[model samples]
Target: MRHLHIRTPRRRVIGALAAGLLCTTGLAAPALAAPTAEPAAPTLADGLALTPPMGFNNWNSTHCRAEFNESMVEGIADLFVDKGLKDAGYQYVNLDDCWALPARDADGKLVPDPVRFPHGIKAVADYVHAKGLKLGIYTSAGTKTCNSAGFPGALGHEYSDAQQFADWGVDYLKYDNCNNQGVDAKLRYTTMRDALKATGRPIVYSICEWGENKPWEWASDVGHLWRTTGDISDSWGSMLSILKQNLPLSAHAGPGHWNDPDMLEVGNGGMTDTEYRTHFSMWSVMAAPLLIGSDLRKASDATFDVLGNKEVIAVDQDPLGKQGTVLSSEGGRWVVAKEMKDGSRAVALFNETGSPQHIATTARAAGLPEAGAYTLRDLWQHRSYNTAGTIAATVPAHGTVLVRVSAGGRWATRPPAVELGLDGSPLVQAGRTAALTSKVTDLGRTPATHLSVTLAGPAGWTVKAISPTTAGLLPTGRSLRTKWQVTAPGSTATGSYDLTLRARYRSLTGTRVESVLPLKATVVVAPPAGVSSLGDLPWLSTTNGWGPVERNTSNGESAAGDGRPITLGGVEFAKGLGVHAESAVEYYTGAACETVTADVGVDDEKGARGTVAFEIWADGTKVASTGVLTNAMPAQPVTADVSGAQVVRLVVTDGGDGIDSDHADWADAKLMC
Candidate 1:
């Protein structure tokens, strides 16, 4: 499923440390190079937070201005206690951005805005702690916060700022990605994680990168929770969009790490009561952070009913912390199930349509334990039903029917030791190939065998083993490896593509099971580099060229209008600048690119009679040009020093001659970057 960018954009991949494979000759092949160590699962404050955090933030409600002062936060802290929210488990009072002054003080320490916090952040921290609630603050990975208010961010001052936060009794930090310096999410986030750990004050590090770099795949150990989508708006569409983006990422969430689909907008009035119910239910199932983004001082009773649902909050705060799984979805109805720490199961029948719908699923099919009779308790309706088979419920449109299915009273037996783990780079460049590898570790008493591995990728893609080997015949205490090579065409654009890995095998107890792991990888394909053809580069505009906006390599036309590969886009130009006919393609230079070159000509098939010259441009300035040629002349060359040039344009212009049959072509054009 394609995910919406939501918050910001950005990732390539780095993986866990693993020994590189050595060939029969004891030499490591270049293709199987080892990757850099990726962000390890954090151990700081290890075992501290075991479930999705429940809290209140100021951004979504107050927009982070002067009105969002200490009084508001204090009121929220008070409301959590008064409305049974604190007793039911919502504890954090988070201030999201705009609480600090524009710049650091003379000591380089961040200063709280005097007008807003009057008594300083330390005083506010004491007020929240007095009520048994934790205090959380916000910062950005960049030099400044998201707003022009200019609160000093946690960039160059990570360690010092972390120490200051610790001194102020800060329990959590919501680190955002605003004005970010294009740093990799892993690098920037892990830096703060380390800084927080160094402070010796257990702060729950929240990574708010806006899901640009597919944080779910790389941010598991970098922070307590990572935002998997963009900032949430109060609108129904925005909330639903974020919810959908976080659906498939449940496998990565557990005890310490959580996937945050931005803060909640439930009591904020952007959505109706039904839509609000669906939002809360979905977030609970996904184990997403339940941060209230509404003003507590004036919250309506209806808001209190939704926000104070103890049963629903209990499911969200379930100690097991496993993200809910979508068991089935048909005709806009979905049945999602989350395993509770107590061994019971939390199931939700959601109606995504606008009208009411009949949603149902069998207990076993919903992944509930023990395929037998179970009692279901409706969380929202506060009703109970004893059923032995299918659990059915009619759900209102844009609403949910949440229930707790009894685990039949006890937990099931644990499985044996054999398991499957996948390790591979999630990137594949166009016109190039990469490898995908899987490993099986056996630690059980039985000797397992007859294992099968299957792989699948996007359409127009190819996958096969680099070298064939025996098909899974391993024993106890043994490890085996499987590999495949993946390739795509140069014309392939950059996008997210999943390379699904599945393994099936029999365990020592004669039980057969299939393990499916989602390995996230993106296909990044760029234009030709290092003395490549110009035709291969994508055109910026065709009106600026001679023919249709694209290149014409085939269609019985020649590269350079003769018979070559220069016409990659199959674009045939008829004239040049004289007849108002022109064509150009932009290429990049500097660092990787040193030179830009091209072959220009008129096709032999069309009397190719036009005054044409080849030209090279650098950042809008004409850098070089070739002699004029008319009639069906030989293809001329256009070469210029493209070193340090950011944008290189290749142009074919009509000479002094008026275009008659001036079919022109620029073949074999390429950049050295």
Candidate 2:
């Protein structure tokens, strides 16, 4: 049960137990180790600097394309140092995967892809270091890298690989969980951790195992930072998904170890500038690593502003180093807070929903300054306002208002982008037959308000006694009281049906402040009378890696290509919000299991190859994987299976990458029980 331990300048030793861990092994003694000397066995402090990591990765910018190259790296490093990013606490010019060729030398050493990085890794590292930026590289714990450009894996050569990185002058290593499988997930990382330490090069160990085995628990003792979510894309869906994933694990970050929500997609044009600001603000509040993924050499003004928000950067680089978490969320609004040094705090009001609304909550609601009135400062707009008691502001649609708070007094202020929320919760879910009652109040003293309620039920369901469906109503006074007799559908799913309520209030000046409430009511729909089975079949698929697999490939292949690992799509399950149902997949890439299937279709030809395999607990466990060995010319569908299996996966080893799968087009895939 390892937990994150924060070392505040005040209570030098806040946790006696952590103090014991520190004392028991002199963990904090090597902070100023000689950089040029033999690497002090790598530690969390070694992986991440006293400051959060700041660097440019190729993922968001190049997306595993030909765009990631030596010139790109050289240009970004120059801008990083020139723009004072390094001086302002940015370091680490990291080159993600795909830089290495698929072939290994006789010594089992990974070779740089001569076509992409013709000058070799040493030259690349020299280039970055010459720019006063540290050089970081990527690898995997398994036999292959996620990109499938078979870099020398740390699997059987952890020690040798670590030494090789040290020899290459690689200052950071993002050791990912590629081919490693089974219950030994941590061991796989631990093996590399120890190996990197043995090199004594002071290489910052970046654990990229994708949040498996709760790396936040002890990874701080091993690596500098750990990715708490699966890899993130530069799209809104991917960014939102990753941010939502980082919300719950907030408490696990502190000091030396930080939760990595993947790289920055700011300035990448995948999302709007406002959305990127929200992304940066939210990540800062989460105390996440600020690795830039966009091409900095040609960043937009908005990107520069977002990446250079001094106030927001302060929160991310706060000495508190404490990660923030979600306090509450409703409709399209979410409130999150981070405890800061000097007992001050930072709160973020996020609007992810459509339509503009006021998102309001108090200090206590933010999990800080409990029971006391505090002054608030808007970090974004740099404004200050003294609320009579509790603080409130009106947020805009798909926007955010960040408030910084201290014990007392006001600070320099600017125009605030105010947002507000309901102080009291509306009637969430009363039994369908039970009467519904709710009280909505305004924190901004807005005048008479209007409220609307919308309810959706089982298929072909209806509510006979309801107010206007597509309309609005004014409130009686400072609050609104409402009630309705709700009836349940006879064939209801016997689960919870979401009920949404939107309240609109007008300020004294007649400005509208809208707030939404979302709750769930359970109907008495009965479940099946007997036990159920999901069946034995392909349960998961990932491209170019492991898990339920589908054919995957990089379009970089000329006639000079051979083979690559099949990376598959990763999945996680949680509650569904009507669009994509969240299903928690227990499988992370590194595990082996039985039974498999893939939902695949081909588009173009080229050398298309895919495989599916599973594992049983014992040796007799049957396993199978299949693929088209040559240029299929056209796309085709395929499947494979085995008997006596526990987990399964499908994969495509070559042909193409990204949305346009050169080898094939993937629709959807799943594994059976």
Candidate 3:
């Protein structure tokens, strides 16, 4: 059996858990216990409060082995107060790793490195206090810190270290977890947390565990804010990937307990200003910590802009700080909407593809209204515009347009809506078979006659209607329509399955809507004997649908689509480019396999429809083919056949004016299989 390891910082863990205890569960929850015993004074939880915490970390500027002094700490403090950052809501001047001596003294006490902090931490704290700012320090939860050099270690010294910091008048502790053992990580972290609580000082705890474990779920029970992703490098790919990881974890964040997705790398010289704005915007939306990980002394004007976008910061610092989620993505265009307090909506349109794309959202989709236009603002450009009843705008390549929506007048306009309803009955198990009974209704409370319904079932499940066996349109009065039927399929695999019912109304307006619900039905089949548990199924990357675009080529070719050399007969497809054909089809391979359904985002830029073909092979035999078609937008993920394909092949034609120069980028080529 493979074991999982987790490392958590002590002060962060404790403060987070304390905040979690403050929230009230739903009506059926048990009554809370009054605090008969107060643990200790608590430090302020950064993101849970009215303003976001601002600070300068040492990692970006001074790595390990940098000298520290009262002047250095006080100099930065003076800059913070001088530049009005503290008045602008920036507090806490933090020192990152590598400030301690090589080893503890004979008494097992941690001491500052004589060469680095000659005056010790107390003098440093006093210096910071004199400048009217709080002082912060760093340490690792593991025996060996991330730094190559071992210094001021906290292993088997949690309680003693907490007392040491308390005695030094430390206001904040930035706890890090690096090079720690798995079994010891969690326990070690908890020890620090409990030890910190034992101290009387109110010190804010910032947990930095590189997100090895899913800390957002439980870190709240321990720290004020905990990192939810791995360390972010000074690169765009790293920044974007980190933000993407934070997207689904939004539900786990709130005011007191935040999901820290590491620190900001905006001022670092790796990304452009526009990309940095997107970075900040997304972070604000995710409500992740805004700890600046750059040198504050010499930051550029553009860097300052990113750190000081008042309008964008407003969303981040909103009293009702809530994270957002992706609603939908189509044709390289995606709509991510967040519900805000005061009955307003925050929406962002992202164009992940190479070309410009138009994106729009309706009030219903945004959970707003059936009527009323809304005021719109372009956050990046800092411009405000009116939006029609339906919000529509064009987004640039690899760019995003974010807007806030509320009731308004004279924005762009769209006609009123046509309502449609889809109904599906829950699935239930009956001995050896699975039964599904469903109904379709024109629940839109309108006098509409024609509506079509499309139902999507789980993979490996076959559907055969037992009653009202026609799969098509149902006609109900303008105000109502209904279609009812029963379905039965037999299988053993049971967990949870998603059922989708799509209703499209073809009228002057041509309205289409979808309804999806989950059915919980248990299966009677038992696992094969001797089975302790089931492991995750294998997934193919090519079938995944969207991935990075390979180089464009005419002659150079290889065997696999994964940038690996494979044996091919006459012609081969390597990455997104195709080689010359000589009597053999272009055979491209996938990264992994044994998947049924996959998302395929094709560039098809050559307008080369029917010129290229996608053949899905399962266990070395062709199972299905997706007919060739050119979709101008390369970013949109298209549904493709992996249905039974263990390994899939994509063959692009080397024929005619092939997508001349534009490179096709596949966002996430993944197989649902």
Which candidate has the top score in lDDT? 1
The regions of model 2 sitting more than 4 angstroms off are 1-47, 181-183, 367-373, 411-673
lDDT of 3 by residue, 1-673 (tens): 0111211111112222221110000000011112213222233443333334556666655455343444566677887787666665667778776667778889988888667778888888887788778877888776656555555547678899999998888877777765454434457667777888799777777776755555664566577777765555554434544555566666666666677777787787656565577677777776666767667677898888778776666667666766666666644366777777666777777654322345677656877775544556556656444333455554443456676766654333321223222332133332334444444432221222244445555565555455542323433223233333323355444333445544444322343333332223322222222211111221111111112223332221122343322112222233223222101121112223234332222333323221223333433344554443233323323344443332343322212211212122222233342
State every prediction's TM-score relative to the real structure. 0.56, 0.57, 0.55
1 or 3: which has the higher TM-score?
A: 1
Candidate 2 local lDDT, 1-673, one digit each (tens): 0112310001111221211111000000001111122222333655245556777677666746787888888888888877777776778888877788777789888788887888998998998888778998887777766553345556888888888889989998887765563427677788888998888788877787666556776676778888766555554544565566567666567776777878887887767676688889998998888888788878877788788787888889998777776666654468788888868778888875322346677766665544333566778766454332355554543467787876544321211112323222121222345455444543321223334444433344444434342223332223344554556655454344655555554433444545454444444321122221212221221122111122232222211132232222322111110011011121211123233344333322222432211111111122332333222332233344433332222223221111112233332333332
Error of 3 at 410 (Å): 11
Task: Pick the winner on TM-score between candidates 1 and 2.
Answer: 2
- Quote model 2's TM-score: 0.57
A best-first ranking of the candidates according to their TM-score comes to: 2, 1, 3
Q: State which candidate has the highest TM-score.
A: 2
What lDDT does the true structure give each of the candidates? 0.64, 0.54, 0.50
Model 3 accuracy (lDDT, Cα): 0.50
Residues 399-444, candidate 1: write the lDDT tens digits. Answer: 7878887745321221223334445234567788877676654433
lDDT ranking of the models: 1, 2, 3
